[model samples]
Target: MNEVKASMAGSVWKIVAKEGEQVKSGEDVAILESMKMEIPIPSEADGTVKELKVAEGDFVNEGDVIAIIE
Candidate 1:
């Protein structure tokens, strides 16, 4: 399993990948809004999305686990 963590503190703007969805490496799985900028969060590994630890509008801190892939 691989954990996809937040690179910076931000509010989750959208979730582009759903649980059980297959994702490729570098694909945007989520988008975060921080400092008035849109930050795209990408998958580091190619796999199915096993879990999403956040929801839209949820605030997250750096290093927080956002999702899991397997």
Candidate 2:
């Protein structure tokens, strides 16, 4: 299993994939808003969505696990 973590401190703007959804490498899995800009969070590997640690409007810090894949 792989844990997809936040790259920077930000608020979750949206959830693009649901649990159990199959995702491909480089696919946008979530969107984060920080510094007044919306940033796309892409998957580093292809896998099924295992868990989402946060939801829309949640705040996260860099290195915090946002989701898991396996």
Candidate 3:
């Protein structure tokens, strides 16, 4: 299993990958809004998205797990 972690502290702007969706390494799984900038959170592993830990409009800190891939 691999965990996709948030790169920065921000509110979740969008979730690009859904549960059970296939994803490749470096693919954007979610986008976060912080300091008026949009930051895309990428998956570090290639696999199916097993779960999403945060929802759109939810705030998360850096290093927070965004999703699980396996």
Model 3 residue 2 CA deviation (Å) reads: 0.5
C-alpha root-mean-square deviation, each candidate: 0.4, 0.6, 0.4
Q: Per-residue alpha-carbon lDDT of model 1 for 1-70, expressed as tens digits?
A: 9999999999999999999999999999899999999999999999999999999999999999999999
Prediction 3 TM-score vs. true: 0.98
lDDT of every predicted structure (CA atoms): 0.96, 0.92, 0.97
- Misplaced by over 4 Å in model 2 are none
Ten-residue region with minimum lDDT total, candidate 2: 1-10
Per-model TM against the reference: 0.98, 0.96, 0.98
lDDT of 1 at 32: 96
Steric overlap count per candidate: 0, 0, 0
**Candidate 1: stretches off by over 4 Å:** none
Residue-wise lDDT of candidate 2 within 1-70, one digit each (tens)? Answer: 8888889999999999899999998998899999999988888999999999999999999998888989
